[model samples]
Target: MERKRDYMTVQELTENEKYKFWYFKIKECKESGLSVKDFCDKNNIKPSTYYNYQQKIRNILC
Candidate 1:
């Protein structure tokens, strides 16, 4: 039997990784035109967590 991939959780992100996480996410969204659910499915992230990140990025930009 094959095991599912062990995905990283949002809480495990180091302070420095925040920039990288957001950058890649925005790039993927902008370039691929993927919805949050689609992007999360492709990247193995949870929707709620992705929402939190989106808010964070919005805060940073504003």
Candidate 2:
């Protein structure tokens, strides 16, 4: 039997989808009233990785 998957792999996502996913994550972090370190820790994200995505999103927007 084939195993079921619950998450999409990065390789399976389009560029737009990847951007939107990270974009919403960054926005959610900002609106959560928590520090970057706290948010990342709570969400199981690496703070550096989150900052990188935030930078990428800002570059895209600006």
Best by lDDT: 2
RMSD of each: 12.4, 9.0
Off by over 4 Å in 1: 1-13
Clash number for every model? 0, 0
Q: For candidate 2, list the clashing residue pairs, or say none.
A: none
- What TM-score would each prediction reach against the true structure? 0.62, 0.75
User: What local lDDT does model 1 show for residue 21?
Assistant: 76
Residue range 1-62, candidate 2, lDDT tens digits: 98989976777677778889999999999899999999999999999999898999999999
RMSD of 2: 9.0
Kindly list the per-residue Cα lDDT of model 1 for residues 1-62, writing each as its tens digit: 97775965666557549767776787677688888789889989898987887787877778
Model 1, clash count? Answer: 0
Model 2 stretches with alpha carbons more than 4 Å out: 1-13
Error of 2 at 46 (Å): 0.4
lDDT of each: 0.77, 0.92
